[model samples]
Target: MARLVRAALRSNEYGFALETPRAIVVDEGYERYGVTAEIASVIADGAFYYLDAPVKRMGAMNVPVPFSPPLEDMTVPTATSVVEVAKALCGRL
Candidate 1:
């Protein structure tokens, strides 16, 4: 992992961006917004040629997660979902 990051750092012509390939980004916020969105945008603009498929992000739903367990379960990404997404990305599912 460190090696990959180091190589990414070196290949980053933009100075701050870390280019990666077939990256799976997961967060606690909206998948299409915030930090995930920023990374996705950067990859799309810079390292897209390295990707075999479009980037996929897993995160909480559009609605705010509540304190209630039931509501949070519906809003947040589950471990199963993450695994499924990863499998789908790798063409395993």
Candidate 2:
């Protein structure tokens, strides 16, 4: 996702006002247990690729992390939300 955003920033077609040093604020949706490391890797890549501003991460509370089937779906943001966050990041640029 961060890579997609970076690519967008590099191109003027994405409606980005700035190029780099952009901030990325994520929601609790991306904080899945199995994919936490992968998500962190994406964050790290963002930082390495001129993500100078703060890479804010807003995730759910660090309890059991919620795995109760149906309950889990509502506990985090959907894919649309994540894209919205990326769009917001682009807007900030």
Candidate 3:
């Protein structure tokens, strides 16, 4: 994932991928804790046309992380989530 981000930042013709386990709500926390939106903005402003596909972001559910183990597990992004998002980005979904 780090490799993908680094490549995206350096190349205008690559797609960006983000996978996180925290809820990225629409608030100050989004910017303070997550770089998904900021990365998108940079891509849009600097390399919109260079993109071959849309940005792919897979994050936790839009809620606070639960204290319980089971609930916490349900809140975060899973392997399936990553696979699905990747497929969608590749136009296979």
Best by lDDT: 1
lDDT string for model 3 (1-93, tens) is 445654666774433322221221122222333656655555555555655665444455668767899987776667776667666666698
In model 1, where is the ten-residue run with the lowest total lDDT? 13-22
Give me candidate 2's TM-score against the actual structure. Answer: 0.38
Give me the runs in candidate 2 sitting further than 4 Å from their true place: 1-49, 56-67
RMSD of each: 6.3, 7.3, 8.0
Local accuracy of candidate 1 as per-residue lDDT tens digits, 1-93: 434544563476534323434667688888765667666666666666667778777778887668899888788788888898888887897
Weakest ten-residue segment in model 3 by summed lDDT: 19-28
Clashing pairs in 1: none
Model 2 C-alpha lDDT versus the unseen true structure: 0.53
In the range 14-87, model 2's lDDT, one tens digit per residue, is 23213555544445644544344344455555355555454545454455656686676666666776677766
lDDT of 1 at 3: 47
Superposed model 3: Cα runs more than 4 Å off: 1-33
TM-score of 3: 0.58
**What's the best-to-worst order under TM-score?**
1, 3, 2
Clashing pairs in 2: 18-93
